[model samples]
Target: MKKTIFTIACILSLNIFNSCSEDIIDLKPPYEEIIEDAIKSEEDVNKFLMGTYLKISSTSLYGSNFFFYGDLLGDTFFRSNKNFGGYTSLIMMNYDPINTGDINFYRSAYDVIQNANFVINNELTDSQLNKQYKAEARFLRAITYFNLLNYYAASPKSGLNQDIGVPIAVYPYNPDEKIARSSISDVYKLIVEDLNYAIENAKAETTSKIYITKTAAKLMLSRVYLTRQQNGDAQLAYNLTDDIINNSPSSFKLFTSTTKDAFKNYFSSSEDIVAENQPETIWELDMNVLNNPGVNSSLSVFYSRTGSKRGLLAKQTFYDSFGTSDVRRDLFSFTSIPVEDNPKGVWMAKHERAAQPGGNYTRNNKILRFSEAYLNRVEALYQLGKNTEALTNLNEFASLRNGSAYSGGNLLNDILSERNKEFFGEGQRFLDLKRYNLPINKGTNCPGNCDVPAGSKYFVFPFSEGQLIINPLAVQHPLW
Candidate 1:
């Protein structure tokens, strides 16, 4: 299936550049000419922008790395010992310095960033082109950078203050030119600038619910500010998103069905989503078999029998975290054959498609969800000492899935645990732990027993070695 898609993509690429290449030796046309000749038509612009979306949805970006490298690699979700290969090597105590997969993921993410930047910097001149499309593209660029910074760079206050993050390329770069990472602060500033521009200029168009919107920009800003510990800014951003959500209560209702139904509904149905939003999504990587193939490889590899055996499974601790009464446990776990020393009870993440019968791919990748926004608001409010309000909102979300509002401990702890349940398998647990300074347990050794100390520097992923090799100005993390 993937091969078929790749063939089609290559054909399309040939068709897209055939004219320019026939007239000029190199396919690299001036940005102006490409925009004037290739993108002047609405259909042409739409098709070209689809390529940008494909990059974000690619296996290296949201489709697989976002889940495996970002979330499952952390302590919360675990790949049972029997299936521990790439994940255990990359994330668990066994640090394999030569993992090429990590390098590939990084390159893929940067490619998406580059494509987005090209569209934003050069593609928006048509008087007839809707402004919303441009805004959506910009929103995607900001999102791509936000993920890169979080994964590749240290916190704002870390000694690597002036350290560079992945390069913030806004224009196409020559393949031969050595790219250098930009400072974390500079990257963030560019993200903010793009998001701000998107919010202001996006008023002229409307897009599918799966695409980013003005509200999605606000939600992302809220996340960015929270990550930087800029409380005031975080509060303001959340407030803006809250206003948008609250203004149309009828449009956004929590899923109050059975946990399985609730979880499935978020992805398969649109009823639970806000009227203008994609159900279960604040932003998603648009994908289709016809135009996207690289984005499908992650799915192929994840469920491939010949690939890494590290299929989804709850860490023993994560599985134990859920009480028997908690329905989410049932929703996420699945029985899978034990790969090695691990027992038969080994579980895999059931949230995503396990495997397509004999085939290995699945459609589309989900990035942000409205539920995350609700949690962000709840957590921010709890931190701000608005405990009562926070609990109220938290319970509102909980009630939808659990059949009753959560009755738990202190508001802060409850919110934290709720996040674990809400975002399980979504690649957020690791980030949440780092942000809150929590400890990571690196699982067992020989028989598989390891534990990472709480707040240890290892919790933070180091910048890729390739990044440093190319950008001498780049700073490595403390322990690396």
Candidate 2:
């Protein structure tokens, strides 16, 4: 819980990595002075926990790239006319393992994980508040590990626990030591352990969209189970969502209104989007002028039409897939803006900024929401062979979106298609594709060279070249 960044120079020789890649250090505010025995009391533990939240909201971890890559790396997006070669590697369908962007994500996420471990191991205070704080820290740790697994390891359909996963750190880090990658099965064991502890100990007072709570913990656990998709996992996931939906109505109810735009209203800038009014939000990151992720890395800088890069634009085919009456299509930009040699402006209006200065960068991030939980349950119920129940849930959600209801057909494809429409520009498509073992079918909007085969190694990103050289114990993923 110290305010100091845990310098990992002893873990990896910084000289091995080029100047472009920062050597994966866990950084806290250098302006603050270090305090010894800092986390011994409740106040100190609270400050430390605030730092953990900051790490989760960091640009490298969840602020920008994580959200963008969640879709860009999978499909349904293309390097737009705004492509200045920034994310060309991602669009090409073969990532440069040593690219600066990849390195930044890998390092930033691990840094956050290490901080959580530090809190879980320490926090000697026996006070009730401290216990809840430590439990929240553990929940953050579980979420970080889960995201890392999504990027660094193969899906359960591919190898389950047999594939290599990122290192699992459960104690305070010592720079002199280095740890090897754990097996995916081994990594998940710790993840489940942490979440179980969090669910039992997390306090009700800490329940909010910006922080971890029992509901968020349950939702994350259901997501983990859904991804694994084992024999009984679908049933387990369905039950977890059903429990949350049936109870916790005051905390996790979907937004409702008499207005026509109720379904798409939340994405726009409004007072209703706040945690208090937006009970539908399970977790989010607060972003403002003072606490923004800087100019280039700002959340709006990639998706909004005002962004310098404007990285994400719906393909023509994808745009047509949406029903004419569906209001979600209003998020895309149809206006034509010129690019150097590429096509004109095919941008997203969903993430646009306010007209005022600095408003472009000032956007709160929604990490998890109740709508996603609702969709998760639908798929799980379908997988459990409860088609009637699945369709009922699907119809409720679709009607809310003003989209057509599901007729009798392939339940699996119907569930996935519903997810695609509901979660467009929300960074859920890529992982869903992976979960379904679907191919990367690019529309006319994507890069020309991007046509990835199903189950390609490209789907699994590799460690930075510097990581392989610096950490001898760390093994490079195949075909890196």
Candidate 3:
């Protein structure tokens, strides 16, 4: 059974290498060709790891769609007529099982997982460096699995439907063997186990924030723990985040200054393709001029009016969610006067670039940062019944962003509201809403379904009909 799945992964990886090579020119010696050599040397292992990063950085995955899909599914942004029509079906939520709108992203994720599996299943010399390499591989595989389950399966907190999860392929299965979705609990178990290994053995420091590090692993683990919400998991999550915020030896620090420039500077400068100087950045995908998602697929293009294909615009209600005095509000601006008459709508300055409209639209995609650590800790504290402590921390975080302090009201809602404000274009709102089982409030800008209920089928995306056909034991998402 294991061998069969392994063979299948290899075949898929070959197709990925051929089709994806043009976009990923930085990855030397195509991944599929290197697999036959068994990744024996240190250089080969590094190339393998870098190849996985390239896959993750693809436009179909984290480079754009992951963040775009999250915000589009939620109430924060609506598609304008300027869009290329690639995601109209996604926003309308009207696509069928045979033509799932996000098939490219699904395939890209599996390509990454397959690359990681190859690195983990092979061995280099018995050196400490090799252990770290394997640890990084596990971390990549775990995070990829978590993303799959988050999108394709019900949350563990979803109760009845939680048993219907995505397929597990940690080891190769026989060619003749059937494949089936693992339970939510089982997939979460793998995520936690792999992250624990990453925390114990991954590299502590590297030249840039693009590489996986122990701190990034800890931050990611806290997210997994918080999402699962099992017994004592909140406390565990809080501890991990707290340690990173207060005790970790790395240079990570929250922005405490009152100046808006300080807050704006936290994001990479427009001239920067890869920012090593940003202290808040824990992990970012390198989008240098040499390798970037082109203008058609770049976030800079989709979110800014300067680009030809600009379509995503901030909803007015969501824009108003930020108070007038809040520094975060400075990140947005109207392209026309009277707000209502603006055809381009409100532009989010988060993904700024120094280029002309037709120039390179490169910008580093930040995956993890210090701000998220504080948010995670605050939520964990609230869950642990430490209301006063959570409030204190929340206010401290808010004050730094030049925002009003939170008075004692509903703590969870306040925390979530802060997250919605802080992570608008960064791709977190929809998933946050889903894990908490909260209804998606589309406000008044919705073009299709106005309100998606807590347990709606739309919350969990469907597998394409081709996917189900290839694996007979695989179950299509319920009600798709």
TM-score for each predicted model, relative to the true structure:
0.78, 0.87, 0.89
Better of 1 and 3 by lDDT: 3
Q: Supply the TM-score for candidate 1.
A: 0.78
lDDT comparison, 2 vs 3, better candidate: 3
lDDT of 1 by residue, 184-252 (tens): 778888888888877676542234544566666777777777676653765765675576567522433
Q: Lowest-scoring 10 consecutive residues by lDDT in candidate 2? A: 11-20
- Tell me the TM-score of model 2: 0.87
- lDDT digits (tens) for residues 32-144 of candidate 3: 34344545476556556667777788898898888887888887887775544578777876666866865467778878887777767664574787778778888888888
lDDT of each: 0.57, 0.68, 0.75
In model 2, what are the clashing residue pairs, if there are any?
161-185, 337-345
Q: Which of candidates 1 and 2 is the stronger one according to TM-score?
A: 2
lDDT assessment of candidate 1: 0.57
**Best model number under lDDT:** 3
lDDT of 2 at 15: 24
On a 0 to 100 scale, what is the lDDT of residue 161 in model 3?
Answer: 77
lDDT of 1 at 468: 62
Cα deviation in Å at residue 344, candidate 1?
6.0
lDDT-wise, the better of 1 and 2 is 2
Would you give me the overall lDDT of model 2?
0.68
